[model samples]
Target: MNLVKLSELLEVSRSAVTQSVRRLIKKDLVSFEFAQDNEKKYI
Candidate 1:
């Protein structure tokens, strides 16, 4: 989910979601990719 949607879903702040996502990325539990149009998708 996008940051805004994720924050709302988790009832957390945007920064918190950002931090958590960063950690998950570092841990290789999640990954992100940017499309040719510059849209980000998480996998």
Candidate 2:
């Protein structure tokens, strides 16, 4: 999900969500597909 939506669901700041997502991306724990607007749902 987008950072804004995720932040709301998580009750956290958007910046915090952004940082967390960034870290996950770096660690290859998260990914996205712009074409399908997919989210990071690790398997």
Candidate 3:
């Protein structure tokens, strides 16, 4: 899922999801792929 959608579904701020995703990405728990539009998608 993407950060914006995840945030909306979770009823949280986009910044919160962004921070969490960043941590997970750094820890190698989640993988992020970028689309042409420069959105991050988690896998």
Candidate 4:
């Protein structure tokens, strides 16, 4: 899901989700890609 959806689902701020995703990315646990509209999609 994208950061907005993830944050809404988790009831957290977008910044919080972004930070977590960043950490997960550094650990190679998660990754993200840009959509056609340039939105980031977490995978």
Candidate 5:
């Protein structure tokens, strides 16, 4: 899901979701990609 959706579902701020994603990325646990259909990034 995208950051916005994730934040909404988790009831957290987008910044919080971003920080978590960054940590996961550092550990190679998750990665994000740009959607060709839109400018949004997905995890």
Candidate 6:
């Protein structure tokens, strides 16, 4: 999910989601990609 949507869904601040996503990416625990529609998708 996008940062803003994720933050809203998780009821957290955007910065918090940003930090957690950064960590997850660094650890390779989560991944994201742009679909054919050019929208971000998480996997």
lDDT of 3 by residue, 1-43 (tens): 7778899999999999989888988999998777777666755
The residue pairs found clashing in candidate 5 are: none
Between candidates 3 and 4, the TM-score winner: 4
> After TM-score superposition, what is the CA distance of residue 22 in candidate 4 from its true location, in Å?
0.4
Q: What's the TM-score of every candidate structure?
A: 0.73, 0.70, 0.73, 0.80, 0.92, 0.69
Candidate 6 lDDT (Cα, 0 to 1)? 0.82
How far is 21's C-alpha from truth in model 5 (Å)?
A: 0.5
lDDT of 5 by residue, 1-43 (tens): 8899999999999999999999999999999999999989999
Q: Write the per-residue lDDT of candidate 4 for residues 1-43, one digit (tens) a residue.
A: 7889999999999999999999999999998877887666756
**Per-residue accuracy of model 2 over 1-43 as CA lDDT, tens digit each:** 5667788899999889888888988999988545355654322
Model 6 lDDT tens row, 1-43: 6777899999999899988998999999988776676676544
Evaluate residue 2 in candidate 2 and report its C-alpha lDDT on the 0 to 100 scale.
64
| Model 4, CA-based lDDT | 0.87
The lDDT for every candidate, in the order shown, is 0.80, 0.73, 0.83, 0.87, 0.96, 0.82
Write down the TM-score for model 6: 0.69
Instruction: Select the stronger candidate by TM-score from 3 and 5.
Output: 5
Look at candidate 4 and tell me the lDDT of residue 2: 81
Best TM-score among the predictions, by candidate number: 5
Best by lDDT: 5
Q: Which residue pairs come into collision in candidate 6?
A: none
Please identify which of the two predictions, 2 or 6, would achieve the higher TM-score against the true structure.
Answer: 2
lDDT of 2 at 35: 34
- Candidate 6, residue 43: lDDT: 43
